[model samples]
Target: MAMESTPNIVGVDLFCGAGGLTHGLVRGGINVKAGVDLDPSCRYPFEENNEAVFLERDVNDLSPEALAPYLEQGDFSLLAGCAPCQPFSSYSQSGRSKKRGMDWQLVSNFGRLVQGLQPDLVTMENVSQLAGHKVFEDFLGYLKGYTVRWSVVECIKVGIPQSRRRLVLLASKLGAQGLELEYDPAVPARTVRDEIENLPPIAAGEQHSQDPLHIACSLSEMNLKRIKASKPGGTWRDWDPELVAPCHRKESGSTYPSVYGRMEWDVPAPTITTQCFGYGNGRFGHPVQDRAISLREAAMLQTFPQSYKFAPDDETIRFNRLGRLIGNAVPVRLGEVIGKTLVNHVRMTQGEIAVPSPAHHGRLF
Candidate 1:
């Protein structure tokens, strides 16, 4: 790929994990100046992949002075924030909530940043369930001064290869702005095969020689046996009593059917869990391929480009850590949709550039 870039709407990403959103923004012809996150582990790939500089600092401590160096006085500045949401996940419904230190206050933490930086634009992405939470309400109220438009939208509607749905919010200080996303079934929704089928086959727990991101983390021996026994889209119900865990005999195991299941090749994979690398973890087993989807395939489904550079060694490839980055990303296509929307709005209101909305593509439908 060539390194062509344009000089418009330079923005900064808050809590940017591996530059997924920033990459999309750049693809839409915007220059991203910096990405800020507390995890230093993010530096390698975030810096390597995107045009932005990587800042290994907590967004909570970010002030106007800290963010000033990354900003230009005249160019349009955008503040984008996506806070960690482990506490609000469906898994948190159990006693998992107490053990998981999901800080409900990050929404307000983001609110503080937007207030301090006072960027011309603001945006965020999170799980759909956040739409009903009180924390999201407070986050919304704080952005009242801006023209706000938020909705619980599906990622597939924006051409992402996955079926994941998330709550997307776009707020601007300029004027009323909203996106009308377009999707066509005739275009063919992407499946695991569409993205990964052409690649050379590798065994479980192996990495490709040509592409490091084409790696798969190892599965334990017990898990290996369990995964072999499991069928694509089928649960452990097919396994013998000896193969079934004793906990399954107990009532607490019935609800855990998604585990140790395989993905249907024709269908969109069930939301890629952090454990998607492990065939026994979720519906991550490659339908006919025998091994689980490789890291590159997983990231591709998350809407990261095929050329994404991941963290350096297997030790850095911890499932939970990398999973949080992939699973919680704002699908790059969605981000592009946003960038296009903002560019159109800024052009229409401020005389920047004239662009067509999806309504103009009505003939395609």
Candidate 2:
């Protein structure tokens, strides 16, 4: 049988940070037209690495009319809205009040665009914890006429070298069915060693001569001792009692053992958080190196290409800002999974690919 030409599915990314999802979508064969984000820092990386324009506008200010120009260019349209997941993350829910403020409403803003535009396809990625919230149910209400499927996807299952998990949603207005991300169990899982072992070694507080982003943050004299005693995949319990922080001596701090820990080289890394560059944050310490992982290492673990540029050489590399961008991004490998699913879904609807049994359609795995 003659294979039909692949459809031209153009996409616009909402809350696109550093073009992670956009880059992955492009790799999966989707033509991303533009990436929209409020951060001006995202512009350089978004445009430099991918064939997309960067729109530095708040998603709250975006209207269907604003996206019309881009949507008109493709045979099928995709609106990807990966709202900031902090408000719905487990870290926020642990002890804080659940306030429905500006951050929480960003998901609603995404729904508004979907309601107004009624695009051919829509996708959303967020912390898996969001699936239990009322806000998530309300977001589903916006997809009344479309076939929807959502599930918590393990990043490692899709070739990401991190222990991160995210909720992924795919909805289609076309008659296609059985939408789910494809994963290959036969494929070997990537590891921290695979991602960063080859990079030139540098001491704590030293920057790699060739790669600016490969610089590690400086450690205090005490932290240097603590890290020196740390073992791969081990917790603070391995530390000498004198090196233990006063906070960890408290009863409540006993519950937080993963902090001030080191990663294991043979396995995937912990979920990269906004403070992943700090040794005291999660299990972010390098398996062998006495310092925390570098910004480049964090980005690479998020499955971003090693060559991905975060900023211009002339600008100073701010650790906090770059960490936030890299941490909050959807793993590029997962985005590629989404893009491939969307492209295959479109082909099924167009009769270019065989549609799966209806019994498997519309499942919420």
Once superposed on the true structure, which residue ranges of model 1 sit more than 4 Å away at CA?
Answer: 1-7, 89-102, 177-186, 220-222, 313-321, 351-365
Q: Per-candidate TM vs. native?
A: 0.85, 0.92
Candidate 2 residue-wise lDDT, 85-131, digit = tens:
55544222322234335356778889999999888999999888889
What local distance difference test score does each model get? 0.70, 0.85
Q: What are the per-residue Cα lDDT tens digits for candidate 1 across 1-365?
A: 54323336778888787777888877765677999876665687788888778987766566777887676643677877567665654223221222335667556778877777778778787788888778888888778678877877766656666778877788878786333333454566677666666777877888788787787767777766777887878988878777787887789999888877777766676776555677667778777666777777788887787878777644445656666566655667777876766666666556444445555442101
Q: Which ten residues in a row have the lowest lDDT in candidate 2?
A: 90-99
**Error in Å for residue 248 of model 1:** 2.3
* Error in Å for residue 112 of model 1: 1.3
Q: What local lDDT does model 2 show for residue 339?
A: 93
Worst 10 residues of 1 by lDDT: 90-99
Q: What local lDDT score does residue 153 receive in model 2, on the 0 to 100 scale?
A: 80
Which parts of model 2 have CA positions greater than 4 angstroms off?
1-4, 89-103, 355-364
**Cand. 2 TM to true fold:** 0.92
Top model number, lDDT: 2
